[model samples]
Target: MAKHSFEFKKKVVLEYLNGEGGTPYLSTKYGLGSNSQLRKWINAYKEFGDAGLMHSRKKECYSFDYKLHVVELYLTSEVSYQELAIQEGINNPALICNWVNRFQVAGLDALRSHKKGRRKTLDKTNSKDATQLTKDFTIDTSMEHVRELEDELLKLRIENAFLKELRRLRLEDEAKTRDLLGSSTVSEDNSN
Candidate 1:
């Protein structure tokens, strides 16, 4: 895909923003490919304004914390990779999807950067054995990962239950102590 200049994107977006034309109309007038690219540029402009409209060739590196947050959002929410990237001001949606895919393939640890070189993958192209590995090995590994997650979830649930029970006991004990002190004061007044 051809990268549009910052000036070009900014002009087109501003024209649309200023009610000169809609994306389709602007796209046609400017000889751009389609309204979709214009829509993305408009969204980026809306999210980050002028700076968002600027085009840069330099690669961006997201922090580990930010990557984790985006990955968690993908895991727990119904938002698609593209929509989440737009909301989070990420220039490329595919990069976010890559993060999620890496997480799924190797868990959170996979999101970390590794040495730049070829890596081993499990898939083999042999026709006869393909289906067997596809169904058995992939499913087995995925299920094992799921079980590990379930175990962690169970531990967290147990800890939460323990904390809640401890809180309830403390509240009950406080109420009992308050009652005893109230009764003693009443008895002293009665005796006097």
Candidate 2:
């Protein structure tokens, strides 16, 4: 269902109450998707006034027994969901429908409240074992990190030595070339 603002619900409810239009006309005029939805709003307005039209901030957590009771009543009797909701003091009739659906699909376990958030994977049977495992893991990771650092340091040293040797060879070659050129010029001068 599309969630309308409190102001919009009030406006629609007021329009209906003030004889401006009926459910079909008001729903069509305001582009309400379901005409039944407008009737629900009108019913809510009559039953609870403005408070029923407003969205509930607090969520109501129903017990498993209560849910089962509601489901059983809905199944066994000829009561409608809307009537059951009012009888059970629930604001939203859709919640009763949801409960009945869940009960049908997944059995009683589905109606039970589940723990919020993820399940814990670690076993907490022995504190000593947990502490031992944590210590061992830390030691293993530290040793591994030290080994990686040593390997990187060795590679860097080798690279530095190789580059140093290459630079020395290049300097030697340049010096030899300069000396050879100087000798050639001297020899040419002597011949002349």
Quote each prediction's TM-score. Answer: 0.54, 0.59
Candidate 2 has which clashing residue pairs, if any? none
lDDT of 1 at 39: 86
Model 2, 1-192: lDDT tens per residue? 437988899999898889998889999999997789999888777787887788898889999778877887787567899888777878899999999898667666677798999887875659888899899999999998996686456445545665676788899999999999999999999999
Q: Whole-model Cα lDDT per candidate?
A: 0.80, 0.83
Cα-based lDDT at residue 112, candidate 2: 77
Candidate 1 clash total?
A: 0
Question: Which candidate ranks first by lDDT, i.e. highest?
Answer: 2
Candidate 2 regions exceeding 4 Å error are: 121-192
Put down candidate 1 lDDT per residue, 1-192, tens digits, no spaces: 447788888999999999999889999999987898898788878887877777656888887668878877766567887689887879777799899888667665666665797887867578767888678998899998996797457445545665676788899999999999999999999999
RMSD of each: 13.4, 28.9
TM accuracy, model 2: 0.59
Off by over 4 Å in 1: 117-192
